[model samples]
Target chain A: MIDIYEIIGLIAATLTTSAFVPQVYKAWKSKNTESLSLTMYLAFFVGIMLWLVYGIHLNSLAMILSNTATGFLALILIILKLKYK
Target chain B: MIDIYEIIGLIAATLTTSAFVPQVYKAWKSKNTESLSLTMYLAFFVGIMLWLVYGIHLNSLAMILSNTATGFLALILIILKLKYK
Candidate 1:
């Protein structure tokens, strides 16, 4: 059974994972990636990919799902950063 | 003994945690957060804080350390975003 900590983790994951949506929307809509750091997005993308791998190794559905979504969002921001730059 | 997946997870945690540094530096240096989404940072800050709590509850050193550092960094960015706005 899922406990309180797991529930907190799930909520944390949801918030952090979904947090990128507004960023993507803001950047895509504004067509502005000026304040965004290219290095951050690049590293974040790679990191999320690694976390996805780690999740797979651990057989964790939560990590896999969250990292996949976060990675995709970070990739979009990276592309947007480069394209909009 | 630590295994390969744990190593990968460590590296992933390091990368994602450190990734915020460049962003905080960029925003502080540029003093331009026009493109940075306030909602994103706000949600991310809260999310990371929650993750830190979850980590502590789980007694995971890795999650605790990484989330603590990442939370601090995210908080700085949030402050910078608001300050430089």
Candidate 2:
């Protein structure tokens, strides 16, 4: 039985996960990623991967799904940053 | 009793939370945000705030601390994005 707090966490996860979309879209459309920090994305990618492992450890669907999606998006951003540079 | 998974979670939290700092530093140093997506930061800020509330509800120190730090950093990024634009 999912409680209110769990729902809140899921919402948070969803928002944070999807938040990367616009940046990716902007970067993709503009082909400009000068302002995007490569260091930040590199660290974030590692962090998200760790979070995915943790989610798997806990068998948490929310964490797993969110981190997976976020990781993929973050990767694209990384590649875009490098490519545009 | 904190286990290995808990430690991994903490590391993951720390990495993701701290990841924003580089972006902030880069933007602050560069004073150029032409490529930073305003829409992304706005949504991310709200997501971090929700994560903070969820963390508080769970009474998890890792989540609370990480989210609080991340929320502060995300807010700064948002402000920098708007200000520099």
Candidate 3:
């Protein structure tokens, strides 16, 4: 049974996770990482990975799913940054 | 009492949240949003705000604190984007 709070968390998770979509897309399209911070992305990626692990421990589907996606997106950005630079 | 899991969550939360500090600082210092994706930040900000609310509902101190900070930082980035642009 999905709790109401989980629903809220799911919504929030979706928003935050999808938010990076455009960013990863844009960077890939234009190969422009001039405005994006590599350090920030790297740190964020690492953090998200940890969160994903934490989510798994907590049995949170939202956290696991969102962090997984965010982690992937951040990885793309990282690769894009390196490739473009 | 803070259990080991909470401690891990707290650490993960701190890392993920604070990860954006350098980013916000760099934008503020360089006044550069060129690399930063406005849409991403905007979406991320909204998401973080929702996460904060969700955290409050869950009674997770780490989530509340981290999301609060991330939300604020994202806001700073957003304002910098508009102002610099």
lDDT of each: 0.82, 0.82, 0.84
Best by lDDT: 3
Model 1 Cα lDDT, one tens digit per residue, B1-85: 8877777877888989988787678788889888678888888888888878876775655667788888888888888887878
Interface RMSD values, listed in order for every candidate: 1.7, 1.7, 1.7
For model 2, residues B1-85, the per-residue Cα lDDT tens digits are 8988777778889989888787778888998878677887777878888877876775656667777898888887778888888
Q: Which candidate should be chosen as best, given TM-score against the real structure? A: 3
Worst 10 residues of 2 chain B by lDDT: B54-63
DockQ of each: 0.69, 0.67, 0.65
User: Can you write out model 2's per-residue Cα lDDT over A6-77, one digit (the tens) per residue?
Assistant: 677788888898887887888899998887789888988998998889778866566788889999999999
Backbone clashes in model 1, listed as residue pairs: none
Which prediction has the highest DockQ against the true structure? Answer: 1
In angstroms, the error of model 2 at B42 is 2.8
How accurate locally is residue B15 in candidate 3, as Cα lDDT from 0 to 100?
A: 80
Worst lDDT 10-window in candidate 3 chain A: A53-62
- Worst 10-residue lDDT window for candidate 2 chain A reads A54-63
Scoring only the A-chain of each prediction against the true A-chain gives TM-scores of 0.87, 0.88, 0.93
Q: Write the residue-wise lDDT of candidate 3 on B1-85 in tens digits.
A: 7877677778889888877788788889999788777877887888898888877886777788889888988998999999998
**By descending DockQ, how would the candidates be arranged?**
1, 2, 3
